[model samples]
Target: MQGVDTVLNVLGSVCLLLWGVRMVRTGLTRAFGATLRRAISACARNRFTAFAGGVGLTGILQSSTATALLLASFASRGLIPLSIALAVMLGANVGTTLTAQVLSFNLGWVSPFMIAVGVIAFLSNSSDKARHLGRVAIGLGLMLLSLHLLEAAAAPLRASPAFVAVLSGLQDEYVLAVVFAAAATWFVHSSLSSVLLVMSFASSGIIEPKLGLALIIGANIGGAIAPYFDQSTTDVDARRVPLGNLITRVVIGAGLLCFLGPIHHWLAFIDPAPARLLVNFHTAFSLVAAIVFLPLNDPLAALCRRLVPSRPQADDPGRPRHLDPNVLDTPAEALACAMRETLNLGDKVADMLRQTMDALENNDARAVKAIEAADDAVDHLYEAIKLYLVQTSRNELGEEDGRRYVEILTFTTNLEHVGDIIDKNLMELATKKIKNRYSFSAEGTAELRAFHARVLENLRLALNVFTTRDITLARRLVAEKTSMREAEMHAGDSHFARLREGRPESIETSSIHMDVIRDLKRINGHLTTVAYPILEAAGELAETRLKPSDQTLMRAPAGS
Candidate 1:
């Protein structure tokens, strides 16, 4: 019963450690995420500054994996050079050891006071940023508190036969112990939590000093593994950063394994406290990794590039370039990626619109064929965007983020439908005109050309509105919808007048000319739909265009 209780108590402590670490990470990220991200990005001007930036960010957040993931996203976007990004990952490994170093201190007394102050500030503060900082304080307190609890939980192991036997097994099976810790860290996705537990175990005499060092080495290796797994679906540039970090860990971790015997002997003679032994090893290992790998970043990065050579995507523009899966954990970044991809998709549709018009004017079969080809690319992007968005954590998104998500999805869907209209309807119209060699009458040609120009102008405006989300421009787009309707009506009337005058070409092609006019108007209508959500969100859209029913009910004043 005592053994079972001891195991349960240790398990609970582990959970508390993880929760506290999570609170710190999420709180810090929520509070200063954007500024910190920019700092890292800007530091990429040089490999050394980039390295410092990684260390600084992970030192604050206490998670090097998070740093790696953020850098991976920047690399995926082509914003940061791959070499600089890999250097950041090297520094992140060193930064992660900060937690282990801090935990090694006897700061348990700080926990209760910090928790009290944190709760007071968190509850009293009105600003989200302040609250997030308060949350960070609370997480720090809990981490300290959990370490205290972990010390107490291991107390029972002092007398338990089962615990002693387990420790003995670990002594003989040190390699297996390393593997176990590595696997556990990978499962939890946190090396800090795992290493701290090993430190706690060693502090309480539940594990040998040599065993503790082995586990810490494993924790480092496992920590790098999770980020690599996360970036599996991203582009080679993104994957390469994590891959380079993993290689550093593997090489260093392997070397550390052989030296553990001698290091343990030397450290035990120098300062024999088991907890310090475990944590100091972790810190030393990481710092060495940073120092050794920092200078080799270029060669390492070159090697990574060679390993994960860029698959030339010149032919696959439809493939999503901005949707780095690593950043999906950061909702705002992911949404921004989706928005950029939408703009790219919109550009494809714009190309189609221009091509179709050129095909009409020049009687160019190739231009019409280009429109058809571009539509397929548009369809590819739409599916990729949908699937990419579906991967985002819906429940985690904020209110504005949720709204933006729907807007992006709706905009992409509308763009896809627009692509269909161009390929299926407009292409057929162009094909018919060219195959039958039915040229429009001069008056008819002039009207169709004018209508096509207006529609194309609106298409350009809609793209700007989608990208900038300028409510005034969106308002302009909505207003122009009515004007476009008026113009379409006028053009239709003009076509009939030409037909009724017994103009032979107009009479002969009356059906085709009117159909072309109707289709262009339809395209303009589709372009206008992009503005509806923007207007509705801004509270500028009226429920009905009709005057209030009360005006009708009361009747005009008798004076009128």
Candidate 2:
């Protein structure tokens, strides 16, 4: 009966420890979210920078899984290369050791204070960022307190005959200890949690220092397995980082086991205290592994490529798409990919619009036919992106990502609208030419072609802004729209002037010229609709263009 009670108590303490660690990690991620993004971006540019970024972020978040997952997300999106990702993963292993250091200290009394402050901040009407920070502090405090409880629970087991016997058996059989440690880490889904438990046993004298060190090493290796498996279905490039992480740990673990004697001797010199000695050894092992593996990142990446060779039709459009539903687990990253696809849709639509316009002006029925077919392709892309966004919204997303999703949906919808407008409006004009037997004069055709060129330029610029989110390009779009409006006004005035000059042949041509000018102006208006939303989403839209002129320069040609 006493043994059952002890088991239950240990289970409860472990649960609290896991919960506390989750809370702390979540809070820290929320508090420094922007900085984390910036760090990721900065690290992507260079291998060394990426390693530093991974270490710093994992140190702040206190979770290697989170860092590993983030790296996978970046690689899947093509934001960072596989070599840099491997470096980052190596650094993350070192960073996760910080949690063990924190748990080793006697800080149980600080738990209540952390809870109080965190709860108050969480419940307060303060900024969301502040509340997030408070939650992190509280979680850290609780984790420390749980460690204290775990130590106390194990303290009783230390003097028990059965418990001592179990510990002695684990110590003598290194293989059993390694297996036990791996199972504990896998079961808890956190290396830090497993390490804390092992550290508690060590501090209470339930396990020898050597066995504890071995278990800690095994836990690190085990914890890495989950992330690697999780990343298996991601991009081929992304799989390399987790694969490298797994290999590094396995190699290091094997080396440590073979040289267990020297490892213990080296630890004794650093710290004679058993618990501290174990912690120091754990830290040292990770740091050394990071340094040793850092230089081999490129070769590791190459090996992963050879092992998980890219398929023959990997980049083929018809190949089974690689966009996994699991990616939606990270909403921000999912939205970014969605946006990229949306931009692709925009480009297709723009091309269709240009081709349709050319077909109309040049009287090429085949181009009109091509435009109609392209519209169907745009429809397909729209459906895919819309479905993706719907799935993304179901996940827990950050505020920025949520808004970006909304913006992308809006932009895609507007692009679709532009496609519809081009196909329908230009087709109507084509019908007019066939039905009324109306053929523009040479002068009218020339003017219409000039107007078509201007409108197509605007469409291209709008698509560019969506693709790159280039503020400079967005501003240029606004400027072009302004210039287009002025050109339309000048053309209208000039046509009126020519009408009164007593040239009867000029009358029919002038009306067609005016129609072409109006259509061009209206196309630019829709293009602006696409541009402004992207600029606004980027928070780069100028204040002057916030409330864009509702008075479009093109009216509906006075009801046909």
Candidate 3:
């Protein structure tokens, strides 16, 4: 029963460690994720800078896997070269080792103090950034506390005969130790936790330093596994970063195993303490990896490219290009992707609008069919953006991100409505006009085409508003609503004037002309809604068009 209790306590400590790491990671990601991404991207001009950036970022983030996943998303989108991404991964590996080195020290005294301070700060702060920082503090405290608890949990097991026997067996088999550590790290999805556990065992005299070193190597290899699989995509470029990272770790790790005996002997001379020896070896191995592999990023990337050849892109226009699923955890990047896909959706709708004039005036059957096909494409993209945004919202989001999320969803919904207007309403009018052999007067035709062109222009403007959120551009887009209405009214009056002149073409096509004008105006209305969110956000929009005094009802003046 004691043995079982000890084992359970050990497992519990490990779980706590994992949870602490998670809180820290999520806190940093939520707070400074966009800045970190931009920092990484800005360093893409050179490999060495990119390497440094990755090291610094992962040191702060405390998760190389997170760094790897972020770089993979960028690589997949062709924002950075595959070679540069590989360099970052090498640096990220070193960064994790740096974290382990810090945690290896006996800062157990600081754990409780940090926890108390963190709790106070988190609960008292209303600022989002302050709260996020507090969350980071709490996570760090928990991590340190978990380490102390883990050491205590392992103390009871050190005296157990069965535990000693298991340690003895592992000590005899270097390969088995590596494999065991690797599997354990992979299962937990955190190499830091695995390394800390190994450190605890070494510190407790439950495992020798040589065995601990082997286990660290395994942990290194295991660290790259989760990110590689998590970045699974049809694009080979995206897969290359993680795969290159894995290959580098495996090859370098296996090669180092042959020298493990000599390395352990050399480390013992510097400091014979088991825990320090393991921690130093882990740090040394990572630094050596970065030194050896940083220069070879280009060659390694080329090798991976050959291993995972790029597949041909799918022919479907409806398939989303920018909505990378891997970035959903990072809401800023995910929202950026959603924004781009929304623009893509807007482009499809614009194409449909552009084709409407040809169908309406020239009676072009092919143009009508193309517009219909374009609407179908718009629908597909709209659905894809909507679903992707839904997934993004599942992650914790800041106020700005939340607002942008709504803007994207609202804009896409409006674009979808615009497509429906083109497909169902305008196309139906075009079909009827063609079948009935209706032709508008010369003036009426010019006015209809001019109005169509103006609406198309507004569609482009709405997309610009969505993309930039420029107040000036948004205000212009909203103002066009009035111009469009007046144009519709003017066209109506002109049609009647032509009717009074007894123009045969106007009389024949009068219903279709009026319907066409109304449908174009309706499409314009949909496009115009994209501006309202932006204006309202800036407090430039009034609640209603009526004056404040207009709210009061006037009594009938002594009604007769």
Clashes of each: 0, 0, 0
lDDT of 1 by residue, 1-560 (tens): 87788889888988998889988998887677778888887888898898888778888889877888888888877889988887777777778888788888899999999898889989998766787788888999999999999999988887888768877788877788778888899899899998888888888877888888888888988998988988897778779988998899989988889888899987777668998888778878887887888888889988998899988766686777667665565578778989988888988888888787677756789998788778888899999999888987552676778988988888888889888988898778778878877777888888888888888888889989988889999999999889988988898889889878889878767777887778888888888988998999889899999866976767967766
Please tell me which model should have the higher TM-score, number 1 or number 2. 1
Worst 10 residues of 1 by lDDT: 321-330
Please identify which of the two predictions, 2 or 3, would achieve the higher TM-score against the true structure: 3
What TM-score should be assigned to candidate 2? Answer: 0.65
Residue 51, candidate 2: C-alpha displacement in angstroms: 4.3
Pairs that clash in candidate 1: none
Ranking according to TM-score, highest score first: 1, 3, 2
- What's the lDDT for all of these models? 0.84, 0.76, 0.88
Candidate 2 residue-wise lDDT at 290? 84
- TM-scores for all candidates: the values are 0.86, 0.65, 0.86
lDDT of 3 by residue, 1-560 (tens): 98888989999999999999998998888778788888998878788988888788889999988888888878877899999888888888878878888998889988888888878888998777777778888899999999999999999987999889988998879899889888888888888888899999999988888888899999988888878877674467778898999998898899899999899889999888898899888888788888888888889988998999877866888888889775676788899999989988888888888888889888888898888888888888898999999999998688899999999999899999999999999999989888887777789989998999999999999999998999999999999999999999999999999999999999989989999999899989988998998899899998888754632535434552
Better of 2 and 3 by lDDT: 3
* Stretches of candidate 3 exceeding 4 Å from the true structure: 1-8, 38-50, 155-173, 205-210, 314-316, 319-337, 431-444, 467-476, 489-512, 537-542, 545-552, 555-560
